[model samples]
Target: MHVLSRTLIDLYDAAEDVAPNEYPAVVMAVMHRLISFDGALLGCGLDAMEHARIFHRSPLLPSDYAKVYRSDPLACRLRLGLRVPVTCECRRFYVARECAEVKRFYQRHRIARVLLFGDPPAGRLPRRWVALYRGVDAGFTRNERARMEEVWPHVSRGLTANRRRHLERHVARRAGAASALMNRSGMLEAQDTDFRALLAADRLDVADGVMPERVRQCWRAGSTYVGEHLQISLQECGEFIVCTAVPLGCAVKLTPAERIVANLFASGLNHRQISERLGVSQNTARSHIAHAYAKLDVHDKAALANTLALDPSRVKTGRTE
Candidate 1:
């Protein structure tokens, strides 16, 4: 495989080992590797809300989309479409209608820079948006633009996959938590629709608990602080697990080899069949099945089947502080 491809895989694998909140940093690293921009930023959840919420923190912005888009000169230049794609939604009505509509809208908000791009894959946007600062050269070199464009599809694909995976995990976690909480009585209320809508975006974390002084201090010191929405509290304590919903035919948390084995298993393949698909010995395939069961916390295929039957939202396993 290509070096960047291998490196990207390694980064993803490593991401699995860290705290859930750390995932953004890992994602940013991947973005840096994929794009050659001078700077980049990411934000989730209320790309509009002003409060410091768990998912809304300006992973790169100063504050809400309006603030960041209005303050950066490069962003303004991009809005003017000096080098960026006019077809991109980021340009707003400026490029959309060629009318003063977008410009007027910006003026209404008193948002000056007007450089912004938001195509939240987890939200209403159909595709991830792109924004760029056409350097002083006025336009990107043909090769540079081409290279950037070449990777855009791959990056978009990766982001889409990641967002879907993230949302699946979020659903699984909420379902599991809600079921558990419900079974234990009314210790926790059913999340309201407003909260649910926010949570559904996969960017918001709304569990209540006490916060450590250090964490609070960190948020305060940052130029952008959206972590308050995370609702981290000091009273809660326990292991938390990140969970994902895997489709009926999909294998969750499996290596490529294991995925092949899982597909074989789900296909009603015996050890011999699985071995053939994996190009391994039947014994090896059997061993892999055993390992898969262990990872899945099941004993036999019957139990594995049962576990798989349960929706991820109904299951809870991973725990993190």
Candidate 2:
């Protein structure tokens, strides 16, 4: 809850030093500081079978990875599954009993360590490995180390949730572009080369303009229309939303009356105006929002909006169970 420590702040800044490739190193270094690890190893899978990029661990060669890649129990689990989280202390018996290749590699490197294995969000990994290793001698005290283990579940859940948000954003963007193309694809069929280019340009301009209006509509809805999902532009649009549409996931669903209220809210209607428009009392309008929060599974309007905008794929189906 407190602001990050000065040391962490410095580490955060330093993380920016290496554009993107340095992420693992920065993460390893930061974690090393936080947890007091002897040495850390980061091996991230890139595009599945294209070969994993190994960093941090020294004298732990590619051959070691190659051997592990084919036979390591953790690696096997990761490759076979979608996403999983595990923290386990692995000894020589693990290598010897599980896989011969792992055993041989372990014998060579004297590899006996506890490992935290995580699969990054779908689409985030293979580009990132499912396994992370920290040498045992890392100076973490018993209590401090236990704290790390205890917090890991929550931290992993948060990270996974964040990754899902990112994935939703990406998929929605692609869907928007595809939808725009489909609208124009009909026209492009009859156009000549030059005409087709002009049509294409016009469509791009129109879609670009339309996206902002959509964002504004979502933002203005306020309490009535909890913005569980929206697509906003990220670029400089004096009139447009942002350059891109964002999908915010909501925690709850809205009822039909609530949906109407939300639409009115987005239209910038005041409570009195909404009541008059919907032919309901002012209290009724207020009640709609209150009920909307319950149905939408949100604590507040802002959170509702954020959730909606971040997770566009969420369609209010049955219960969220």
Cα lDDT of candidate 1 equals 0.40
**What TM-score do all the candidates reach, one by one?**
0.32, 0.37
* lDDT per residue as tens, model 2, 76-162: 665554343444455544644657666665546544454444444454212233244545523324554454444333333333333
Instruction: Identify the runs in model 2 with alpha carbons over 4 angstroms from their true place.
Output: 1-12, 15-17, 46-56, 80-85, 95-98, 120-127, 130-321
Q: Ten residues in a row with the worst lDDT in model 2?
A: 182-191
Which structure among the candidates has the greatest TM-score? 2
State the lDDT of candidate 1 residue by residue for 1-321, as single tens digits. Answer: 875677467555644454434554565555455443443333332222222112222232333345544443434444343333322222433545444544453444333222234433333322233443322223334554554544444444454444344433444343222211110111121222344333333343334311223433443453221231222121111222122211222244455566556545754679876666556899887877777676665677776656555534233212112
Clashing residue pairs in all predictions, respectively, total: 23, 34
How does residue 88 of candidate 2 score in lDDT? 46
- Against the true structure, whose lDDT is highest? 2
